[model samples]
Target: MITRYDSNNRYSKAVVAGGFVFLAGLTAEDCSLGIEEQTASVLKQIDDYLERAGSSKEKMVSVNIWLTSMSYAGGMNKVWESWVAPGIVPARATVESKLATPDTLIEIMVQAII
Candidate 1:
């Protein structure tokens, strides 16, 4: 069975199935925000989704991160490292790409098992 949460006209923020959750790419609502603030917002969204899906960021198995500006990677990584679990950090891949939202600097999507 599949279940979706926090859906809107554009996308369902997260979906769960077979005891796992797949979260949509998360970006800050206010694109004008700097990388640090944007990263904070993204992490908060991830936290909320994981909680609703019976999991947590610490339980994330993998994450796909995209930064519109490659130069911002270092900044984003700093925030990511702070949120990632110390001993059980998830596998992650970070890449540079143009985001759908012009001002968005970063986007993160995650997969986790409850």
Candidate 2:
């Protein structure tokens, strides 16, 4: 069975299926922030979503991060390293991509055990 939460017309923010929770790519609400702040905001959203899905960052199995520019990666990583579940780092990938908005610096998608 599949369960979804935080839905809008476009998509559900998170879905639970096959013993896993899948989170849609999320961006900071305040896009004017720099990479570090944006990254932190997105990660905080991930934590909330995971908890509502009966999971946590430590249960995350994979993460995909997109940045508007690779130059922002270092700043992004610094916040990620501090926020992520220690010793339970999930499989992750970071890449430079054009985001949906000019002010959006980063977007993050994650999958975790439920």
Candidate 3:
């Protein structure tokens, strides 16, 4: 059976099914932060949800990151490289896209197994 968590008016923050947890695109609570800060914040949020779902970054299988501008890639990656599990990092793709708001720098979605 499938389990959903953190449901809001727009979406469910996570859905657990078939031994996997899928996280919705997470953005920083403080949109005023820079790319590095935003990425870090987003990762931490993901971590919290993962823990709640009995999983962690080390168990992640895939990730999709959207950046408002390619110029922020370097900044975002710096924080990501440090936060990711040491070995066998999840497959990830980073793309430049127009976010919902001008101040929003990034959004990240994660998938992991229990």
Clashing pairs in 3: none
Each candidate's TM vs. the true structure?
Answer: 0.94, 0.97, 0.97
Backbone clashes in model 2: 0
List the candidate 2 regions with Cα displacement exceeding 4 Å: none
Cα-based lDDT at residue 16, candidate 1: 98
Which 10-residue window in model 2 sums to the lowest lDDT? 77-86
Query: 53-89, model 3: which lDDT tens digit per residue?
Result: 9999999999999999999999999999999978869
What does candidate 1's lDDT look like per residue over 65-98, in tens digits? 9999889988888987898888999999999999
The CA lDDT at 37 in model 3 is 91
Which ranges in model 3 have alpha carbons more than 4 Å from their true place?
none
Question: Best to worst by TM-score, what's the order?
Answer: 2, 3, 1
Badly placed stretches (over 4 Å) of model 1 are none
Model 1 whole-model lDDT (C-alpha atoms): 0.92
